[model samples]
Target: LLELRILLHGPAGSGKSSFINSVDTLVDAVSHDSFTTEYKTNKIQKGEPGTFYPFVFTDIMGLEKDTNKGVGVEDIKLAMKGNIKDGYKFKPASTISKDDHSYNNNPTLNDKVHVLVCVVPANTIHLLSNETVTKMRDVRLAARDMGIPQLAILTKIDEACPEVKRDLRNVYKSKSLKKKEFSVSLGIPLNCMFPVKNYHSEITTDDNIDTLILSALRQMTDFGEDFVNNLYRPTSSLQTGI
Candidate 1:
């Protein structure tokens, strides 16, 4: 099985569930409400032989401020256990001290996160509050600390104006400049960001959303390649035979 532990984190109502649902229709069962995914996994099997085995996707509750003090954080830690079996063991998100709490769970400096997908609302490109910016920055820092490859998904693009879309692209290009500035002020390296428009469409034609989603998946595949290259060198002991 080509197992991957992909994390989807962002503020409430950022379309995290929607993005996961777009990847596979089966995920729709667990996608709902503002914080519907307390903790769940959706599996997609590639029907073709010689192709990668089923890909399991774990969806956790949205990480809010003070999530570590709540039950939701423990749920995320529990989910990490499954990833450990897949060769990626994350430090339990629950064990981190309250004072040292971070948005992204960093079990160790050498932690290998296959991919970190940060969701942002496309309609509100520059509508982030001070607290939101801080949280976003911390996520970026945590990804950097774990040496994980990362990408940003700008959701709800259909609801955004052209001007907002342009601004969103610029912010993405600048690593959400305001957040990047804060990271720099705090001495954190910014992770690379990519802007993807993930939306649900009524039409099922060739020009429909499936194409866009497939493109996004391809981008993720490329990012995964780079992450594996960085965290596990070809000559390293961790290298797999597959």
Candidate 2:
């Protein structure tokens, strides 16, 4: 069976990698400096050996405020169309073209991104630079043109709000995030925005963390399945023709 492809993108240190690790015990490379350069697709292994879940996650380098640094917005557009390949290193100076060795000329429906999740730090929403927000919105518009569903993941809620920090149950009650403000900023609806704390510095998995992660994941799969089911192309088609 074909697995849903979920693509994650956002500013530096927004917890994209950490969220993936929390969702599925996969080992994704992370750094304190917010440097993730490789394009990687992660699949969750099922209980049985050599088996995987019905969905996969793709992680890319974080977006930077500088136009000449970090990942370019054009590269993200290509990724959504499945034009980029795994392990492809991002070049800030240029984007991948048809002649690039890392380009994927033939991409199936499974290779295309079913859902685009923008991961950002909850506490830093108000502090995001104008350039970064513009970059994010640019990518969102591209996804919209391609008919891809988009959502936002607000990470580090504990650090963003003291009330939530005391108890995760107070997530909705806390007024710190100002959901509407960020919703307007990112062009994402209140319903599509999800708040979750990624698993970090914890020796064992916590119920609260798992609940939040699973909640967002369930939503992702739901949106992804809806997109895949509505696709005009056959599931087994190898070329997207885009």
Any residue pairs clashing in model 2, and if so which? none
TM-score list, all predictions: 0.61, 0.91
Model 1's alpha-carbon lDDT is: 0.51
Q: Give the range of the ten consecutive residues with the poorest summed lDDT in model 1.
A: 81-90
lDDT score for residue 229 of model 2: 64
TM-score of 2: 0.91
Candidate 1 per-residue lDDT, tens place, 98-165, comes to 34323334333222246667777756645655555566667666666566666776666546645434
Can you tell me which runs of candidate 2 are displaced by over 4 Å?
Answer: 26-34, 232-242
Clashing pairs in 1: none
Candidate 2, residue 137: lDDT: 94
lDDT per model vs. reference: 0.51, 0.86
Off by over 4 Å in 1: 25-34, 47-54, 65-112, 162-208, 229-234, 240-242
User: Positional deviation of 32 in candidate 1, in angstroms?
Assistant: 5.3
